[model samples]
Target: MSPSVTDHVVGRALSWADIPRLVELEGRLFADDAWSAPTWWAELAARPRRDYVALESDGELVGYAGLDLAGEVADVMTIAVAPEAQGRGLGGELLALMASRAREAGAAYLLLEVRDDNAGAKALYARAGFEVVTVRRRYYQPGDVDALVMRLRLRDERDGVGDTNG
Candidate 1:
């Protein structure tokens, strides 16, 4: 098994200083669908409603994730791991961080959308206990790729469904 991100990386709140690096990584990782620098700035400007985390190894940023908390629901804005840092469980750790943050904010559900072509990411989300709630046909432009809307219930105990507090 690969080393877990927590074994060697330090995680902290993401700051303005990370925008350039994040944009670069987004360009590399998401290619045609990468978020622009201005979009990132807007996301940061949203303040307490939007929360983000950055992970560093040896003082180099390796991964980051963001969440948008809105009442009983929280949406995952994005999650990215540098190419060199992939397969180290950093993605899962980042995803867990988002989920935990959402739950802490009293969110009952967490939602995210991933391109259907991204098998690895879909697998990661599935392993993290997310289920496909819907599919947006041709949601990704240019290539016309489909997007899978996945959701995880953060607080389902009242309906007799097991809580995901673990």
Candidate 2:
């Protein structure tokens, strides 16, 4: 990813003061299945290994995402873009940022579990260099859908090639 595109928006650790608006975006994008306010707070505050970021456009938050880094492994926890901002490459941008953070933290691999039904999210991760590693049965609630576990190696490096991570 190029820094030029990153300049259009800014990402920073989520602040407790931004919780209300963050909840609003999460509710709108994830419906009732979104993680609770307390969860976000803990990830942003209590968890030293977790990295939570909010993507803002024009001074208003349009998306949010977070990753949990464990040693040389990182797991993408949540990523949601406002419906209005969908299809603008924001998801990819957010993933790139998270992956970059993962690499900078010395992670050798990144993992994510996506709903089997969410092809859009799966595609984004694939394009970012992730591959399906396994599946979890009846992972999501309200509809017993399975979850696809995907993995991407961050150790691959080739000069002049665009590494998926921003």
Candidate 3:
């Protein structure tokens, strides 16, 4: 069952203490390309430039996301929700939080790469105003899935309108 807005969902900046759970969830969600604990520690070491957020319900981590901010572009490194929490808008919420953090850090655009076969994630990105900018062939190992690179303009180029409300 999907969680509703009234569910006891709580979101906050991810910290070192959450790395273990995040790694466990990562392995479960992306067995083939799961990041190792050392990699996650490196990411966290990067600090403010690489922002991450975690979502919890009933004191259990249910979702997490990370963004890499570089100059005017912010690339979404990862976003995942527990399988049991899939259809409850948690992914969208995480994306929004990442975008907001990126914008605050002066990013002008947000970018992400999704497996070509992930129709649901692709649909969500599309609904969130991301446009397919390019494709990287055989991006994912093991399965050898192609990657759809998507970009979302975070600011109106003409008027410099930013996504402060994200």
Candidate 4:
């Protein structure tokens, strides 16, 4: 079920202290594809180039997202919401936050790769104005899932052509 108005869901900057919990959530959310602690550590160590955000509901971590800002183009590194929080509007909220950050960082475009099998995620990206740029065959290993490379034109938002709010 979705959270109610009194749920107290909040978004904040992600920190090193939240890594352990993020790892736990990654395991549950991504299974074999989940990133390891060391990888997360490296990501955190990247500093200004990489930005991350965490979401909590009633003081408990429920979602997280990260972006890699690379001047003209910003890429979404990851986004995951706990199973219990799925289908709520939290994923969109997280996405919107990332898009806003990318815009503020002077990114002209936002890019992301989503597994083709993840219909929900694809739908979310589509709803946020991301268009499939290309498809990478069997990009995801073990299960051999295809990856859809998507891009959103953040530059258009500056000219009031598109929604940068994701």
Tens digits of per-residue lDDT for model 1, 18-128: 999988889899888898999988999997999988989778888898999998889999998899889977788888888888888888899999999999999999999
Full ranking by lDDT = 4, 1, 3, 2
**True lDDT of residue 59, candidate 1:** 82
* Model 1 residue 92 CA deviation in Å: 0.7
- Report RMSD for candidate 2: 3.7
The all-Cα superposition gives candidate 3 an RMSD in Å to the true structure of: 1.9
- Summarize candidate 2's per-residue lDDT along 1-166 as a digit string, tens digits: 4333344474777789888888788778775377778877787885668888888876788888888889878999899888877787888888988888888888888899999888889889888889999999998887998999999877666532335548
Model 2 has an lDDT value of 0.81
Clashing pairs in 1: none
TM-score of 3: 0.91
Local distance difference test values of all predictions, in order = 0.86, 0.81, 0.85, 0.87
Runs of candidate 1 with Cα error greater than 4 angstroms are 1-7, 159-162
Clashes of each: 0, 0, 0, 0
**Tens digit of per-residue lDDT, candidate 3, span 1-166:** 4635345454578888988998889888986889888999999999878888888887888998899989899999999998878887878888888788888788899999999998989998998889999999999887889999999888878887874446
Top candidate on TM-score is 4
Supply candidate 1's per-residue lDDT for 139.
94
- Which of candidates 2 and 3 is the stronger one according to lDDT? 3
Q: Lowest-scoring 10 consecutive residues by lDDT in candidate 2?
A: 1-10
Q: Which one wins on lDDT? A: 4
